[model samples]
Target: MFSPEGPTLRELAVQALSSVEHGYDLLAPKFDHTPFRTPDTVLESVAKALGPLGPFEDGLDLCCGTGAGTDVLAGLCHRSVTGVDFSAGMLDVARRRATGPVERVPAGPGTPGVAWVRGDARALPFTAAFDLVVSFGAFGHFLPRELPGLFTQVHSVLRPGGRFAFPVLAPPRPASPAFWMLLGFDAVMRVRNAVWRPPFVMYYRAFRLGQVLEELTRAGFTVDLRALPEFGRRDGGSPRARLVVARRPDGATPPPAA
Candidate 1:
């Protein structure tokens, strides 16, 4: 669903036909008005879930679009928060937001400073610089085969014992309309990519949780899952949403922070 201020259907068509980076650049200005942006409720829930596990220092928001998750990190991290994304348009919006009078979670006397950088997720440009890394609603751009390298990049940016955290929703039941909708969306995308240049990679079903956990483990993280009770349980009593907290072992030595 999109608000009146959101991109027009024609504008969305143009974006969908563009490369992922360019598409986001075109959509960046009105991104928050679209349902495509992560909901504030989810951000608040994740912040609450991560509160106890942190008193973190520097933090990074990987693939941060418009800086919602970075705002969460500003409250939790004491030193500094950096938001990195591949889209210059998105980064521009994020930068303006950091200096604006938006209502953000109050971060006490040591509120971390915020910075925005442009970089690809597959090759993050930081060295053991973050004690915590959080991402929200951006993984679908990456293919399943890219998970290992992506996780490795996340691992490389974190200090020893640092966490790479994100929230993931449980897949819809096959019987549900939502399931068919997502299936159809993915099918359309596949067909489009088959004929289109500069493939726009967004798939609802590609990021399987089980495969993701295995990749995180293979990438050297001690993975843990925490249920976000706010979203409530499904008919089967399983959590509808969960937070994945993957920590780099404290014993592993990493290069000095850049």
Candidate 2:
């Protein structure tokens, strides 16, 4: 669902047909008005979950589309907060918004200065520089096969004992309408990629939690899952939302490539 200021149907169709980078570039200006942008409620919940683990020095927001996650880092990190993404258009919007008067986490005297960098998440352009790294609503753009390399990159950029945090929602039950909606969305995306060139890689069902935890462990992170109380619990008593906090072990380096 999109607001009146969001991308039109024709604009969305054009974006869906383009490469992921180009599609996001096309969508950047109106992204906040679209449901694709991470919600404030989710951001607030993540900020609350991360509050105890932090008082961190430097932070990075991986795949930081329009810098929503950067706002979260600004509150938690003390020294600096950087937002990195592959899309120049998204960075432009983020930069502009950062200078604007938009409502965001209150930046106190110790609040870190924010910066935006254009870089691919799979090959982030930093090394052991950040105490914390976060991502929001960007995983679907990455294929399942790419998870190991991606996690490795996140690991490489974080200082030993630093964390990579992000929130994940529990998958909907098979009988639910939301389940069918996501399944159909992924199916359509697969079909579109099969028939199109410069494939737009966005699939809702590809990032399984078990596979992610394994890859994070293989990448040298001790993973912790914290339930977000704001979203409550599912019918089966599992958390509706959980924050995946993967910490690179103290004084440890990334694992050697396979």
Candidate 3:
């Protein structure tokens, strides 16, 4: 669902037919008004979960779209916060939106410092510099094959014992309408890519938890999943939402080939 200011059906069609980067560049201006942006509630919940893990000196928001996850980092981090995104248009929006201090409960002090950078997540520019890193609602942009390199980059940026966190929602049931909707969307994307020039890469069901853990481990991260009880559990007893904390070891290995 999109707001009145969100992209039109025709605009969305144009974006879907373009490359992933180009589509995000086109959508970035009105992205926050669309359902694709990570919601404030999810951001807040993640902040609450990560708060105790911090008072961290520095934090980074990976693939920070409009800096939603950056806002969360600002709260938990003590000295500085950085939001990095590949799309310049998206970075512009994030810079504007994350300019002021973030709002928080109990009327306490605002977040740590904030900055925005335009860069690819697969090739982060920082070293063992950040105490924490978080991303939200941006995984769909990356194809399954890219996950290892992406994870490795994030791990490379984080300081020893630092976390690379993100929330993963359980996939909709096969019999559910949401599942059918995603299936149809993916089918349309397949058709469009067959005849189109640049391919947009976003798939609802491709990023499986098992595959993710394997990649994270291969990327030199010790992975753990903490169930987000607020979202409850599925019929098979799996969590509806999970906070994945992937930690790069103190002596992390050099990143493998892309």
* CA lDDT of every candidate: 0.91, 0.91, 0.83
Task: Give the distance in Å from residue 253's predicted Cα in candidate 1 to where it truly belongs.
Answer: 5.0
Question: How much does each candidate deviate from the true structure in C-alpha RMSD?
Answer: 3.5, 2.7, 3.4
Ranking by lDDT: 2, 1, 3
TM-score of each: 0.94, 0.96, 0.92
lDDT of 3 at 38: 85
Q: Which has the higher TM-score value, candidate number 2 or candidate number 3?
A: 2
Model 3, which residues run further than 4 Å from truth? 101-111
Candidate 3 on 88-151: residue-level lDDT in tens?
8888888777655433222335546677777889888888889899999878778899898888
- Give per-residue CA lDDT, model 1, range 97-214, as digits (tens): 7853333333456777777888999988889989999999999999999998899889998999899999999999999999999999999999999999989999999999999999
Per TM-score, the best of the predicted structures is 2
